[model samples]
Structures are given as C-alpha cells and as structure tokens.
Target: MKKLTSWALIRQNLSRKPVRTGILAVIVFLFSFTLYCGTVIGQGLSQGTRTTAERLGADALFVPYGYDAKVQSSLLRGEPSSFYMDRRFSEEVRQEKGVEKVTAQLFIATLKASCCTLPVQLIGIDPETDFVVRPWMASAIDRPMRDDEVVVGSKIVGQVGDTLTLFGKELTIAARLEPTGMGFDTSVFLEIDRARRLLLASELGPRLNLPAGLDRNAFVSSTLIKAAPATDIKELVNRISQKYAAAYNLDFVVVAGMITDMAAKLSFFSRCIHVFSGVLWVLGALVMALVFSALIRERKKEFAVLRIIGASRSALGRIVMREALLVSLSGAFAGVAAAMLVTTLFNAYIGAVLDAPSLEPGPLYRLAAAAGALLLGLMTGPLACLPAMRKLGRIDAYIIMREEL
Candidate 1:
C-alpha cells in the first residue's frame, strides 16, 4: 500500500526491462568515457611539450653525428642509448662568443639497473659547470654530490639513501628529483668521475667496448649550451653547425625546433580526437532519439491507464523524463570512473606510445573535465525524451485503451 509516485513508478519501469535500460545506459556511457579520455590525453600532451621545453633550459644541444635521433629518443621517450663525443668539444663550445654557458654530460644506457626494472639511462654531470641539470638538483640536495653518491629521477624505484648497483658498483642515492615528464624521469645522475670509473671497470665495462684512442675519462655524450642574452639563436646554430658539422662530425639540435615539431604533431593528434568525439556525440544523440521514440509507442497503453487513474498529462510526461535522468546519471558516473581508472593505470605507457611525456593535470582540471562530461551526459537524456514527453501530452486515454483492446 505504498504510494506509487512518479519516481517510484520510474524505478519499477526500468527494473522490469533491465536489458533495455542497460542498452540506453551503455550508449551514454560510451559517449562520456570517450569524451573524458580524449580531453585528458590532449591536454596532457600539450602540457608535456611545454614542460619538456622548460626542463631542457638550453638554446641548443650538440651530439655526435648520426646520433641526433638517439638523443631525441632518449630525451623524449626515455629510451636508453649510449653515445660519446670528446670532452674537449664542450670546452671549445664554452669559449664561443654567443655562448653564455656550456655543460657536458656522458650517457650510459644500462640494462637491469638496480634502480628500475626496465633499462634506464645513466648520466654523468660536472656539478660546477652543469647549467642544465644542476639547477634542478640544487633543490633536492643542499651539498655537493660525492663520487659514490647518485641522484635519481622521480620514477626511480628506491628512496634517497637507498643503494643502487650500477655496473657492479654500489652507489648511494643522495637525492630524488621531481618528475620532469621527460626521459630524465627514468635516468640516474652521478658525478663525472664516478661515471668514468664505471666505464673503465674491467669486469663489466668491455661489453660496451670503447672506440680506439677514445679516452674514457675524456668522453662526453652531449654538450648543452645556453646562448647569451639577446643572442640570435638561429645565427648561433648556423655558426656552430658550420664549424663543427664537418670538423667534429657533430649535430646541432635547436631546442625551439624540437618543441615546435612536437607541438605540430600534438595539434594534429588533438584535432583527430576532437573530430572523432564530435561524430560520436552526434551519433549518440541520433540513436537516443530513435530508441526513445519507439519506447514511447510501446508504453502508450501504460500512460493511458495512468491518465485514467488520476494522473495529469504533465505527471505522465515527468515519468518518462525521470527515467531518462536516472539512466543518464548512472551512466555518467560509471563511464567517468572507468576512464579515470584506465588512465591512471596506463599513464606511462600512453606517454611512451604518444612520444610526449606529459605532466598529470591538477585536481581542478580533472574536476572541470568530469563536470563537463557529466553535463553533456545529463543533457543527452532529457533532450532525447523531449519529443516523447510531447507525445505523451497529446494521448487520449479512452482512445488508447480502446486500441489496446
């Protein structure tokens, strides 16, 4: 003897045809899920490119000829690679007229490093001369890095003070840096002397055999240069390339050019996702309209009976709308939750696949995205039911009952 209110009736109605209700809910779920994932992914990539550019903090980079791609992959995708250039190359670059600061780093791509399960890049830096990485490290460690002490990137497994074995050498972790959304996150940083020691160690060093006449103590992987104030970056790049390209067989990588290229690719990727989402939105709306129209027809007798039993035209309309609202709300919550879970679990893999390591968005951005997706989801149901509600308003109870017979 419970009162049969509109909401109560709607609950009963949906419970009776569970399959149909599930179908409608699934349609909305797909739309919302796709929208939320696409939005987050696009924003993450754009932000990642900006973060990477800031992290580089240099005008241009110099690497051995034919190894530019290797350096790019190592920086952007966290791919472990080993290449070396003469240490004197950095000294020469430091003396250039337009060069404000110059620093060199040595690279060793290690397999089965104790810091991570996957292969990670090992970097060697001179704390005194390093302008690129030293600033970031300063916040993590107050004192100078010792020969046996190493600094780790954010993604490295162990905490500060933990010992990690590198090339059979046990090194202490002195500090851990904040995430940079670049290959550096999986890299380990050490002093130049320690790096050279590992490279010269007889037992495990010969596997990456050094080229003849290339002294381990005098080899570096890349020369990072910061241009002087108001310096013409293009002219500087051209001058350096001309001087070193043939003489030293070096490649010049302009940081700005790298970012611009990444941005263009990200723009195209974002557009594709936006267009696909738009198409899905339109298709979802159309399908909802058709489904609801048929549902209203099938329930004509049910509405007519309610009207005879003291239900107003408006009340009957409310019944249909309330059902749609319930389904939409449920679908929206479920879809967004699924998207969040998937993204969280596979964030690193997604970045690797996209080749753009992006910083995770703040909570406010996530809240806004969820709100937008839910709003769209909520709107779809009510708008689709509008025509059905109108149809219900014009139903003649007596005529409908007669047709049912």
Candidate 2:
C-alpha cells in the first residue's frame, strides 16, 4: 500500500506542472550529454596513444652517442634532427647471441628544394630487411623504392607520381603510408643510397667527406634490434651499448628508452584529461543538486500534507529522492547515447584532424561511465533534499491547516 501511494504521489507531482517537468527533463538531458561527450573524448585520446606505441614494434633502439635528446624531441614534438652511426656496428650487433634481427636506418635533416619553408625528416632504410615498423606498409603501397624513388608519409601534401625536390635533386613519390601520429608522419622515406647522394649534395656535405670510393650505404644513422624472447631486453640493450661503445669508439643510445619516455608523457596527458573530465562531472552534479533543491522547496506544502496523513518522514524523503534519481538517471542515459552517436559519426574526421590514430572506446569505458553516473546521482539525491526535508520535519498538521485557512 505504501509503495502504491508513493507511485500515485509521484504521478500527481509530475502532472501538476507538466511545463516545469518538461523543462527539468531538458536540463537533465543536456547535463548527461556533457558528461558523456567528455568521457568518450578522454577514452578516445588514451586509446589512440597506446595504439601508436604498440605499432612501433622495436624492442630496443640504437642511436648515436649524443643524439638521444634529438631523437626524443623528433619523436615527441616533430623536431628536425640527425644522427650517424657506423654500419659495422650494425653487423656486430646482429652477431650478438640474443639478437634476432637488426635493421639500420639513416636519417637526414633536409629542406625541400621546391618549398623550403619547414624542415623534413628524411629516413633512409634498406627496403628488403626493414620489416619492424609498419610491416604492412610495403604491401599497402605496392611498388617499392628504386634508385630515385621515395615513399611519403600520409600527411605529406604531395601525391604519388609528384616530384619532390630535396637537397636540389628531384625524387618521385612512389607511395604514401598511413599516419602514425608520430614524427614519421612528417618524414620522407627513401633508399639509403639515394638519401646519401642528397646529403652529400648540400654545402655542409664536405664536413662528412667520405673515402674516394667507399659505398655510402655502408654507414647508417642508427640500428634497431629485436632480441630473442628468452633474452632480457634491458640486459641485451646494456650489452649492445657496451659492445658498440668499445667497437665503434662512439656513443650508443638506446631507442627503447625514448619510446618508454614517450609512453610516460602520454600517460601524463591521459591523467590530465581524466582530471578535467572529473571536474566537469562534479560541476554537472552541483547543477543537478541546485535544481532539485529548488524543486523540493517549492513542493514543501505538498510534502507537509503527506506528513500530516500518517506518512513517515522516511517515506517522504524516499519520494523526494526517487524523483531526483529518476531525473538524473534519465538525463545521464540520454547524454551518453548522444555522445556515442556523435563520436561514431565524427571519429574518422577527428583522427584526420589530430593526425593521430582513430580513437576507440572499449567496453570497460562504457561500464565505468554507467557506474559513475549512478553513484553521482545517488549522492546528489540526498544532498538536494536536506533543506526541504528539514522544513517538512518542522511543520505541524495544525499549523499547515491554519495557514491553509
């Protein structure tokens, strides 16, 4: 009987002011939408960062002695830098016990001849053996680089077949690879031989003067190694560093450290996003609390009448809370649905705009958002009723009747 009475009372309150109820519903919908959109965006950014990291498959990276800072700057912030290492070190590293595969790359910092506005990171790799990063890249573009051909990053404005003049020589763009949201997206990749020729053509080329007939391809900027599963990756890195230090008489920096550092930076950004989302959620709760509190105050007399008719204070409080919970849950649900729909519709466009991988919100994210909303609603319900409940407690049946007279 109490349950039925509560339901009837709820229906009566809702019907009494249909216009006000409709307005409150709209407010709830808007609040929910804000919460849902913030959560989806935060989840998308976190996923995108992790995906980029996973795609870069190198267990450890080997670079020149002092170029560690340069390498990290390039990877994280798209800064232009160069490094150099002897090709002999590549061969020796491959001969190590736990080394599975070793690949060397030459990176050149050069300006485009046609449009020399910004610097470009030109990468030179042996097409035959370079399979670690974006293994499917070769197949995706079909034709491989020849003597004077190059593959451009997806963000490269030039199209396939267009001639891009670097260091005064023109090279054809054979293909374009997908964007990785890293410095690579702004880079151009070509055969080691071609890149060497372009580097030597510059005025600063004399600084790196080579032997009269030495093969330019015999030297590289860095080597990337994939160690055996049984091998400790860090141990392998330390061993390789020592070996390269003794053999080449040059500094050897680990690329894996740079990757780990990048991961840490990404994690920091994720936390910042989480905090911002949390703040927005709190603001939404506060708004709901104010709206509910005002509604309760206006319904004081109605609550008093219920109290007069043998309704327990606990029962009146439950009804008030039930109304708040219903409104909050409905709003939250509507907001989340709208956010998902918006995310789905614009995900591709957002990925392109950000020049990062597409954002993917997993199942865990949805479950957490739902749970958070429920807890928030429950907490806000009681707080919103405090003032009205106090007023109801003080009202006597005779006093209310006298006021009514």
Best by lDDT: 1
lDDT score, candidate 2, position 307? 78
List lDDT for all candidates, in order: 0.85, 0.66
Model 1 Cα lDDT, one tens digit per residue, 1-405: 899777888999999999988988988898888888888877777878888898889889999888888998898877999988878878887778899999988888887877788999998888879888888888999899988899999989998889999988899999999988788888999987678778778365666566555676688888999999999999998998888777667887889999999999889989988888788777877787787888989999888898999999988878888888998888888888887777767767787888777666667887898888888887778888888788888899999899867
TM-score of 2: 0.65
Kindly list the per-residue Cα lDDT of model 2 for residues 164-254, writing each as its tens digit.
8887777888888765656666678888767877787677677775434334557677677887878888888877777677556455445
Off by over 4 Å in 2: 1-49, 112-117, 207-218, 246-272, 298-405
- For model 1, state the Cα shift of residue 65 in Å: 1.0
Q: Which 10-residue window in model 1 sums to the lowest lDDT?
A: 202-211
- Alpha-carbon lDDT of model 1: 0.85
Over all chains combined, what TM-score does candidate 1 have?
A: 0.95
Which RMSD values do the candidates have, in order? 1.7, 7.3
| Each prediction's TM-score versus the true structure | 0.95, 0.65
